[model samples]
Target: MTQTGASRNGLPVEVHHNALLQLLTNSLILSHTTPYLSCYDVLNLAATSRAFRYLVYHTPQVFRHVQLSNVKAAQFSIDGIDRGGETWRNVQVDENLTEDDFYSGPLRGIFSSLRRQNILQDVQILSLDGLSVTAELVHDILVDPSFSVRILSIRDVKNMNERKLRAALQYACRESRPEGTPRLRGLYVFGPKEPAPELLLKPPPPVPVRKAAIPAPPVAKAWNTRSKKALKVALVEAPEPWYARRGDQFPPRISSEWAFTLMACHGIIAFDTVLCTGPRHLNSPAWGTVNIDALNAADVPHYGVATHSLGGCASCGCAPEGWTVWGEDNLATSREPNERRTSGSAISEVGRFPLLAPPPVHSSNIKAAMCPTGQPVNPRSCFPSSTTGKREKACFIPRCFNCLRDRYCNGCHRWWCETCYTGPWATSPGGHGGASNTGADLLLGVWNELP
Candidate 1:
């Protein structure tokens, strides 16, 4: 008797089984390397067979870093006036489309269904912009204990309110935990302009200065004695202080305008280095020099000046001359424009001058030579730019012992501009430093460095 081998019609059953196993193995490997795979891809695989469905459901990285944008409500209506003596109203999505469009309907349905399965925890970064979702919806996602989203970046959100934004930030910060905590490490919220402040008070100091400097002593003397029988003392005049003989010109005194301007300038600087050379008609080199001198006088350290070229003269506009400038050119270059200020020659002129150091040719390999901590050095971080327009009128008031801007309201004890944190509302005015407050007094407190 001939035994019948497993077969379907003319095909052998063992041959079919091997083909199925091979296809399943290949699909599993392909899913690992694919980046930004949409939810539809996973759903299609799941529908292919029960074995494929299991693999798609269990893959963690497939749903990681999900980015969704331009999502609007299906029933929303847009109204526009037409030129043909009629108003045009358009309704794009309806019941028919919802039933027929797999992406707009069935895919959304699948995501909605998976929402209950806690599959969204696999999403590490959720970037939502120009979506019709409300702030309440954002809060819900952030507060959800099961959601593992770590970085939420929402930009160009026109409908978002400050209260909602602040609430969402507070929730994100609160929900973020050390362990088992949603890895929500950062929250970036940006818009065209800042919302009217609930409260605006004098920003805390190191008042913004254009070219703050560290002044060296006027003279250096060495003690000399001729034998024990005859002891002689000599007094030598020290070389000129960096600012000596220069006019009263110095860096701008730190003020609210300075802080805001620096923030604006830094933002421009980060995006394009050429912005440093841009025109500044309002404030001249002398103004910046005075501000720098004030910063030096205040003994506020941690800041450094950047210039086009190193070791160039302060007057020639070629080197970083702190607060000093020689006409249109930098101080050093003005004396001799034809001479090249090399390291050896730089020491000869102006005794010793800091030269402009070229930026790293390849930023990736460039590392800061010195650590910022334990010393006076500006901590460089990626900070947002100011949204306020330039040339916003800022009043500068000189309160003797301290050049304070915007009068301090005694009732509130806070210094304020026309907008917020004005008289009677301030918790503490003249807090940083003034005649009312002692220099050593812990009024404004000390600068806190960022990690």
Candidate 2:
């Protein structure tokens, strides 16, 4: 083990507590040495002794980026964990106390005091890792004095009523007032295999006309049969298949080969990325760059007004600019309602209601998208024999690495359905044995940079 000390003749010299404190808190020491320590390291030092704890606890700026990893539900309380606040009666109470205050206990009182006094008010980024956080805690930490928190992260949190957290944050955003606290700007929520809310599962928009027409290239009959046979043989030898255990919850297919191909193609569940062994790559800096301003800007025509093509109006028999003619056509078309059931390919119209158009996704239904759960595999594992999926390259917003549903990696310019080669905006590769969603964690900095 490595040791740090100032020793004479291989023996450490004893120093007075006051002298040690002076040395540790010296201007040169803090500026030159403390900067070398990470927030985690500083927190560890704070736990070592009272003097160190006093310095670290009071100095919020030094530990601006706080990460509570795998923190248990029991630790959320400040009652027995700290001896700082011994009496609730002695604590100052203003006229704002409500009737509910009488029923609350010491921990709530401690949190109330912390908020009233503005403790942790300067913290910029707060990451809540694990599922132990309660709605009450969320409500307490995100209101008034604690509202300055800019980025709030929830990782691998399961069994959480996300609605409560969302409600609390919405309230915080709406209620920041007299104190002028900054509302939270960025939110990151990720889970390993959690189910998403039903609202996000809107049937994927009717397969567009262009995509429905593209047919897969023909393959030899013998090759297809051989692939199916090989897949069955492989699956028979493997451990319990995830599909068999999950029942019809996963994508449905008739044959074992088709099942394997469908899962691989859609990337419903991926263990290959998690099980691969190699050195992890560092995130590319370019992932931080995004034109959010342009994305959110009102839709605008790229061409100049004069450059627009002219067309003769069918009814008026006069040359009109392309946009004006288009607008007229759109207005005329708008008067006639589109048929809920349109004439299209068999697959395109499947599973849609014949009586109603697909409803728009409202603001309330969005939640974490989850990858399908499946059997783990090693690096040498192979897919169904002779089954090759097409490479997808288009990207979308709010992409997720776990579930390819309705999203894609913006930085990689590839669909989230792929199994390899993601940019920094995607999930962390498994080689480092760190969190699988490191990209989401790093997103705090990117979001905080926004105007």
Per-model TM values vs. the true structure? 0.33, 0.31
**lDDT of candidate 2?**
0.33
lDDT: worst 10-residue window of model 2: 351-360
* Model 1 lDDT tens row, 1-451: 1225656555566676556546546644544433344455556756887766666566665555554542233212234422333422221244333212312332244345557766776766565544334465556555676566654545444345546544554444442434444344334332221222222232235535456665334442122113311321121222121212111111322222222222222311110011111011112222232223212224322221211211221113222222222111132222233332332112111101211111111111111111111211222332324773322111111111121223332332233211121223233444321123222222233212212
Model 1 vs. true fold: TM: 0.33
Question: Which is the leading candidate under lDDT?
Answer: 2
Q: Which stretches of candidate 2 lie over 4 Å from their true place?
A: 1-6, 9-54, 72-119, 175-182, 191-451
